[model samples]
Target chain A: MSTEIDKSKVVLYSYWRSSCSWRVRIALAYKKIKYEYHAIHLLKDGGQQKTDEYAHINPMKAIPALIIDGHIIGQSLAIMEYLEEYRPENPLLPKDLYARAIVRQMMQIIGSDIQPLQNLKVLQTVAEFTGQEEKKAEWAKRWIANGFNGLEKLLEKHSGQFCYGDQVSFADLCLPAQVYNANRFNVDMSHYPLIQKINKHLATIPEFIEALPSNQPDAEVQC
Target chain B: MSTEIDKSKVVLYSYWRSSCSWRVRIALAYKKIKYEYHAIHLLKDGGQQKTDEYAHINPMKAIPALIIDGHIIGQSLAIMEYLEEYRPENPLLPKDLYARAIVRQMMQIIGSDIQPLQNLKVLQTVAEFTGQEEKKAEWAKRWIANGFNGLEKLLEKHSGQFCYGDQVSFADLCLPAQVYNANRFNVDMSHYPLIQKINKHLATIPEFIEALPSNQPDAEVQC
Candidate 1:
């Protein structure tokens, strides 16, 4: 089950503020896997991700594509799993099978159920459909609040210091970016205290801090 | 790494037409794992999944929750991974690590990207936001088409007889349900020949046929 890694040539195509890309960055930092960063501007030049070359690298035309083990891996969750399997050191998953499943369940509550509804392209589509730009944030806020309601309840049973009993699992990797997006959308965090507590605790961790969207190379350069 | 399964008590909370639930059903059938089916009717009596008892079982209040190995595992991908790990006999993932990542990449294209955008709750929100019931189908079709465009390209490089090589991996588990959904939304399948081909091939497999929406116990039951 072990795969050899040629770490020198590892590359990550990422955007500064993409919640999905931020998840991968957290995993890479937590696992201490060094990679070349290629910024794909989601807002500049009519969305650089839509370029044919980027599309060739990642058919999904999505951020957080990883070039590792001589293959192009797309999808943040997929990339994180590859990183976990590729470098099992500093493991991002639990050793117990059920705990691992729980961690994944928590991860998907954010990744699949929440983030996709609020990501840039989907938000853009929402704007187009509604013909009201302000509706985008309103749309994002409602879905994030909906997902966080369930997540906060789940966390009440699962949280110790992290999303899954004190371990900085993949679910933790998802939490900060989502909270960041939530704040941007003006989601009322008063209702989800557990999520806020976990997000605040994760802030003090070096790996999580280092992967912050504000710290990425492409964070504030004018588009 | 193996967790003992109490095959007798295995329970699945599912809705017949849910694409996510169908995924777990397919994996269970493929691996010959028997489970008790508890129908969570998504449209009857104000959605059985929203009941307090079901919410307690799955905090996310989502369908396709598996009660196995003394744990209530939520999320279809997580349940499938548990199935793969709990009983590794007819593995749903490829042996090679990189190939496994590719398989997962393919799965998330459908799971995270496509399915979520068009799932019942999201579509319901779409209808509410636009104040037009007809917008639901249009929204679903657009997102499905957007994802299928990328998926068809990925399949071109990866497909042999299924979504990833000749094997019936988890990606293959995801295809039929999505194509079923796409067809439900009246998406033009001519643009995604690879998806159509894989969907066609999956139909011949007994495991897939047995898990089809029409075969589920609750499929045609009246409200």
Candidate 2:
């Protein structure tokens, strides 16, 4: 089932501020895969994703696309899971079926629940269509709180130092990227100590640090 | 890993019009898993999910909850995958890894991309907080089309009789449930012949037919 892929041959179409992109960046770093980054400015010129060049690559007009051996994979969770399956050395999911289900469930809380509500297009459309900038923040805050609360409760039962036991699974990669966006939008997090503690621990990991928005070349211009 | 349980023991907390519930229903019927239908009207009493009992069953206050062995699992995709894993006699995923990934990506297009944009909560919040029903529909239409277009392209490469090479996989369960909702909102399907062909094929399948909103006990009162 394995194909020999040159480590340097892989390329990621990413945006530094895109939380979806951050998920893949962390997964690649954790898997210790060497790849080149092709930064796509999601906000530029009504989104570079809509351009003829990028449309040929991804019709969905979304960031965080992975190009491996001339095959393009979209969807952050799918891409991350693909990497885990191909590069099983440093596993992102546990070997046990129940444990894998738990980890995948936690990832779903972020992927399906939190991130979609607060995606850049959704928020931008919220403002454009309604002219309610404050309510946009309110929308993001409400859903983030809703998702994080459920996650906090789930983690309380299983937390050692991360979202699922002690391992830095895909859940760990997803949570910090989402929480970081939530913080930037002024979503309060003082109540969940476990979430705060896990984020603190995640901050210390070099893979996470390297994938931070601040570490990307495009971060300065956007900020 | 197989556990025997009484046919009458299965319980589903579902809403008649919910696309999520429809997905689970199809999965359960496809696997021949008999279950009791427990209708929790999403709109009644400002949503029955907010009630103490329902909330206890699903902390997320979402629909399509599967109660098996007295344990609850929410989120339609998660519940469907769990059923597929537990009841492998009728597999919903392909035996090969690449085929499985393709099925998963198709499911992701619905679960993560299309359905999230048009979710009840998202539309309700947009209407209540932003007073932009028209714009919300536009947003929904855009994402749905985006997802379907990518799916259509993928199907070009992958389809034989379904979204992933003939056999009924999780994608079959997902696409019809989503496209049904999209069409209810007048999302034109004229362009996506592949999707249309598949959905037409799926509608005749007894499992999907049984799960239709019109067939549910609570459909008349709710819709």
Candidate 3:
């Protein structure tokens, strides 16, 4: 018999400071699309996203749910693809099918492999279970580094100013968000020169600058 | 400064019992795509996937790297999309723009949200950190139920014989693999009748049965 576990709490999440959220934001900025941003305080009021109000806006009860023309779309990658599908003005994926798969491969390294493991909730759960609350940062650092190691190898062949080519595509959008996350967790990037170099290069792009957590209206003031 | 963390072990994983691998397998089977299955043996010989041989094939060192015509594709969802793009025969996604986004959204609820948390490496890491090896099953169940809760609700509006309408889209391919995982973790499914119903129906199909973990060539002998 299975014990009743928590239901209705979904985390295909988009948080104010979440890397996944930044992934969508950067892509949107690259496309030069303007949209209003809402601050769903994840830590305040026991998470505004958990409320019944937010659930109606998004049955999944996740942050970063995009409301386009009264239709709501959840999941960061899905939103990215949707924008690519409908807008097609500023394409984010490569033209070749195989090349597109390559771009997505790198994005998933950050999206699925890294982001989920370092999620704030998952880290809290780990800390509680481990009885070492301070280890949350360590958990985030470890997972980020693991994914970056593979990513560094991946970019060796794919890089030329951006992931998979000179153009700003899906991989470029994902890398900055990951690097921002890696910096938050204080992941040492000396071992990953390519990643560090590419991230530094990306940070200079105006679109990337616009999407940084520090630039967001809802960003917390850090000392 | 971030402490030295484990690196280079990527999880473009395709282990015999892994949930993501099964998703791609079911989709591949559904398309009547015949391909060779190579068992990289995740646990044997100190993880064959970690070796230089496998890295050449996929530097990510993950399992189920699908090599077609000398072009290797990694990531389960990426592989599935690649199939849909290249094959276009027996489509797995809806034709409508918003509908495609919807299909991909559910896949992420499982792929990015659930599967990553319940990954064997992640679970093992949690067990090691928490020193509660037995609680691993509880952890797995908790995440599965959490994702399924939202998934069940999403299905109320979209489901027919499968996850979305009558046609087997990307969401249907991802559902059974997660359901198989839920069963192993003993997640309570009473609240998720739609999911339960869809999975029950999907299992009866020969393609899904052929892709089940127990039927894999590398599967260990059952008592």
Cα deviation of A57 in candidate 2 (Å)? 2.3
lDDT head-to-head 1 vs 2, winner: 1
By TM-score, the better pick of 2 and 3 is: 3
In order, candidate lDDTs are 0.89, 0.80, 0.80
lDDT of 1: 0.89
**What's the C-alpha lDDT at position B176 in model 1?**
89
Could you tell me which residue pairs clash in candidate 3? B14-B63, B92-B169
- What order do candidates take by DockQ, descending? 1, 3, 2
**TM-score of each predicted structure versus truth:** 0.95, 0.90, 0.91
Looking at candidate 3 chain B, the ten consecutive residues that score lowest on lDDT are: B1-10
lDDT tens per residue, model 1, A13-40: 8998889999999999988888888899
Q: What TM-score does each prediction get for chain A alone?
A: 0.94, 0.93, 0.89
The best candidate in terms of DockQ: 1
Q: What is the iRMSD in Å for candidate 3?
A: 1.0
lDDT of 1 by residue, B126-213 (tens): 8888888999999999999999999999999999998889989999999888998889899999999889988998899999988988
Position B61, candidate 3: lDDT: 74
Model 3: residue A143 alpha-carbon error in angstroms: 1.0
Provide the lowest-lDDT 10-residue window in model 2 chain A: A1-10
Please, what are the lDDT tens digits per residue for candidate 2 over residues B128-182?
7766567667767777887888888788878878888889999899887778777
State in Å the error of residue B160, model 3.
1.2
Span of ten consecutive residues with least summed lDDT in model 1 chain B:
B1-10
Tell me the DockQ of each model, to 2 decimals. 0.75, 0.46, 0.63
